[model samples]
Target: MADKRYTTEFFLTAAEVNSQREMPLSRLVTTIIDTATAHANKLGIGFDRMISEGISWVLSRLTIDIAESPSVNRTYRMTTWIENVNRLFSDRNFEMTDAETGRIVIRAHSTWMAVNMSTRRPGDLTPIWKGFDMVDGAPSGIDNGGKLLPLSGSDFEMSYRFAVSDIDVNRHVTTRRYIDLITDLWPLETYDSMRISRFEVAFKHEARYGETATASRMAHAESPETATAQIAVADTPCCIARLHFSER
Candidate 1:
């Protein structure tokens, strides 16, 4: 039997870090997705298996809470496991820890669905998940299936054209690119002033290459630490996200 959990190790490199030499939010989120993909593949329920059946994994929602962002050249470890699964959606959890000090760098939860390639509809998860082990009841900071907070009073807006490089194997805009686009709305000085501590996003629709999209964001009324943003194409929301910050 395969282990119910999976882990991988890596060090922050130039490619994953920003100008300040800290790992960017998008890179950290990419780590979460990468670990999930590797584990899913190990369980025989990942991309290769799903794609063969005319299905692909679609990220529905994700929430990442970071305690600290590892600096360049620092080794870290990431572990992930299946928390729960239903016919329509699966919940996965992850933890990132400093390899030297054993301190946690991040904890995240994600929701994914098996989508039919042609129909663009969610497919049943039961058939392939029949014998998979789920490590239910583990501590997860973010709950699956919660309502995504809407972006209100987003007075800032930027129009963008989806570039060819942003397209992925799914023939749609890569999710990571959307994250970078949203993060770009803030000036570099803002990132220097505040550190993103938590981020949550809900995927609503797909944006394709050559499509034009608008990114909008605003600070929440309650505190300077909170923010909300939305990405849309033709005025239809493609994805929405909220980021929580903490002063350095």
Candidate 2:
């Protein structure tokens, strides 16, 4: 039973966005991660168990396809589940929808590896799989196409002053918080109608609480019918965010 499913709801706040009053893409992704983690905890398959058993899950890759953006005050629902666990890694799937219309706004595919806590490196997943059961068939028909925004050029520029709340147990701004900042730059309407089909971000430098950091984006691709964004920091690039939109 390594696979589990979950759902959650939360408010979209201004502090979660930039001047355009939209929820940052980074924040949205963070919420999804947290919600999924909480769901696993509720089912007794939490992170604590994984770590204590000499194994922990690490997000090796993530691909988010956004079809629509959630606006402030709007109620949104998120559903997540484990697709499958292999000898070395596991695949997780996520779906986001507008609570009101039930229209899917986002979808994601993430690859995870179980690591040995003592060794601080990847470990075999066989022991981890023995504790869990397959929920059902694997996630089918998910489009694995698209790319994140290039973290370069002058088309976009911004930054954030990390607050006390931004710090995690690791003493650095968490990965999800960074994703929130990037998503916040898109327009509400654009966010609502677009679905992120691919989102891949990696952590390099760590930003401490109360420290200021700038964010920048490059136009990887744009058109009246579709758009993609690439986000980064000053000189050092952090992640690439690709957003696929639906025409209004």
Considering summed lDDT, which 10 consecutive residues are worst modelled in model 1? 142-151
**C-alpha positional error of residue 1 in candidate 1 after TM-score superposition, expressed in Å:** 0.8
- Tens-digit per-residue lDDT, 2-95, candidate 2: 3356788766766665444556666766776787678668766578878778887666567777666567767788888878778887777888
Candidate 2: misplaced stretches above 4 Å?
A: 1-4, 11-21, 145-166, 180-216, 221-238, 243-248
Cα deviation of 63 in candidate 1 (Å)?
Answer: 0.6
Q: How many steric overlaps are in each model, in order?
A: 0, 40
**Cα deviation of 95, candidate 2, in Å:** 1.4
**Judged by lDDT against the true structure, how good is candidate 1?**
0.84
Every candidate's lDDT: 0.84, 0.65
